[model samples]
Target: MKYSLFTELKSREVIDLFRSVFSESEGEAEGQVISDFVSSLLATTKPQDLIGCIAEENERVVGCVFFSRFTVPSGQAAFILSPVAVSTEVQGSGIGKELIGYGLDHLRSQDVNLAFTYGDPTYYSKMGFKQISENIVNAPFPLSQPIGWLAQSLDGQEIQAMAGPTQCVDALNDPGLW
Candidate 1:
């Protein structure tokens, strides 16, 4: 398997991968929602504000994840991971973890201060994320699953308490998605 930057692949191909993966696991309707969300993220986010990675085998995309600029009250450079997908056939093969690790490393290299992601705690915990309280860093929207709001410092420092509300890219600002 090969890991590469999202910019190196076609947007349509990645979108289709998400649609197929999500459709198989989360049903067709959810697949479309995530597919459209990814489409918006790719089209609306500025190149510098977005970081994405993909996993490929034999030149075919098998997994993908995106991290878009996340605004925190502390004014530190940050990004949020969302809407990750791996082809159904490749699920549980560690491609998702590897893809995320690659993206996080890339963010660290670029001097990004923090990384946030909203997802299953057990799943993300394996990647070094810890449960973060809203009191420390408020999520942009009221989280439906607050326990899933997680973060980690890329520079090996503790995540300090941040005041005020957080902001995500417009594509990820929808309440329905929270």
Candidate 2:
């Protein structure tokens, strides 16, 4: 049977479980930036903005995702989707999809309209995303992903004017990530 729950970042053991799952993600980068991003986000956001997923089988977390607030030029409300990972052994089990879907539903509940990420739309679009050109600035990643830049608007309204060079959010002001 499949099970999932939404929760906060939580303590060390959960973080460790998340890291193990992340090490298997497609862009697997030694999970160095992911750890830093988690720390930086924890320091930068309110207790409410950081969301995670605990996917379970026999009550053990085997997957997770991180969604936190980011200040777009509008300074209204937006979500930054980073670090979604499933256990290396459970890649085809759909855990990653459930995690992302939960995050999206939570954002919907909060009336959040936008979600941004630098990843393939093929995977993300399945979670209700599409390529967006309104990227005002580059992502904090070292590698450029012009085509990989995408956004998913929860309200069903397209964001044609949302493009611009992005500046780092105070919550994400880690100079290294940028």
Candidate 3:
């Protein structure tokens, strides 16, 4: 498998990968929701504020992940990982984790101080994320699953409490997505 940064040329393929994977694991409606969300993210977000990564094999996109610029009141450089997908056939092969790790490495090299994500704790814990409360750093929207709010300090320092609300890119600003 090959890991690389996402390019606009692969936009359709990446979106389809997310749609198909989510549709299988969740449902068709959920898949369409994710597909629309990714489409908006790719179209509306500024290049500097979005970073995407993909895993490919035999010239097909097998796994994909996206990290968009996240804003905190404290002005720390941060990003949020969301809506990750691994092709059903490759789910257990670590492609998702590897794609995420690759994205995080790129963020670190770019001087990002923190990384946040909302997902299953058991799964994200393997990638060094720890459950965090909104008191420490609020999510852009009120979370239906507060326990899924997770973060990791990329600079090896403890995550400090940031006062006021957090903001995600326009595409992720939907309340339903939380």
Candidate 4:
């Protein structure tokens, strides 16, 4: 397996991978929702505001994840991970974890201070994320699954409580996604 920036692969390829993976896991209607969300993320977000990584095998994208610019009231550099997808055929191969690690490393190198993700805590905890309270750092929207609100400090410092609402890129600003 090879890992690289999401931009390294064709946009359609990444979109299709998400569609396929989500369709298998979450049914077709949800798959289309995620596909459209990814399309908006790619088309609407500024390059600097979006960071992505992909796992490829035999030159075909098999997994993908994205981190979009997140604005915190504290003014620290932050991004949120969302819409991760790994091909159904290779779900147990650890490709998703490695791809997320690659993206987080890229974020660290770029001096990103805080990384947040809304997902399964059990899975993301394996990636070093811990459940964060809204009282500590609020999410952009009211979470449907409050337990899934997770965060990690990329730097050595601990996460400090930030007040006020957070902001995500337009593509991720939708409440339905939260």
lDDT of each: 0.92, 0.66, 0.94, 0.92
Q: Candidate 4's residue-wise lDDT over 4-57, tens digit each? A: 887834799999988989899989998999999999999999999999898889
Which has the higher lDDT value, candidate number 1 or candidate number 3?
3
lDDT of 3 by residue, 116-146 (tens): 9999999999999999999999998889999
TM-score of each: 0.98, 0.78, 0.98, 0.98
Q: Which digits, one per residue and each the tens of the lDDT, describe model 1 over residues 10-50?
A: 69999999999989998999999999999999989889888
Q: Model 3 — TM-score against the truth?
A: 0.98
Task: Give me the runs in candidate 3 sitting further than 4 Å from their true place.
Answer: none
Worst 10 residues of 2 by lDDT: 1-10
Off by over 4 Å in 4: none
Better of 2 and 3 by TM-score: 3
Count of clashes, each model = 0, 8, 0, 0
> In angstroms, what RMSD does candidate 3 have relative to the true structure?
0.7
How far residue 38's Cα lies from its native spot in candidate 2, in Å, is 2.2
Writing each residue's lDDT as its tens digit, candidate 2 over 14-33 gives 56665565565634575655
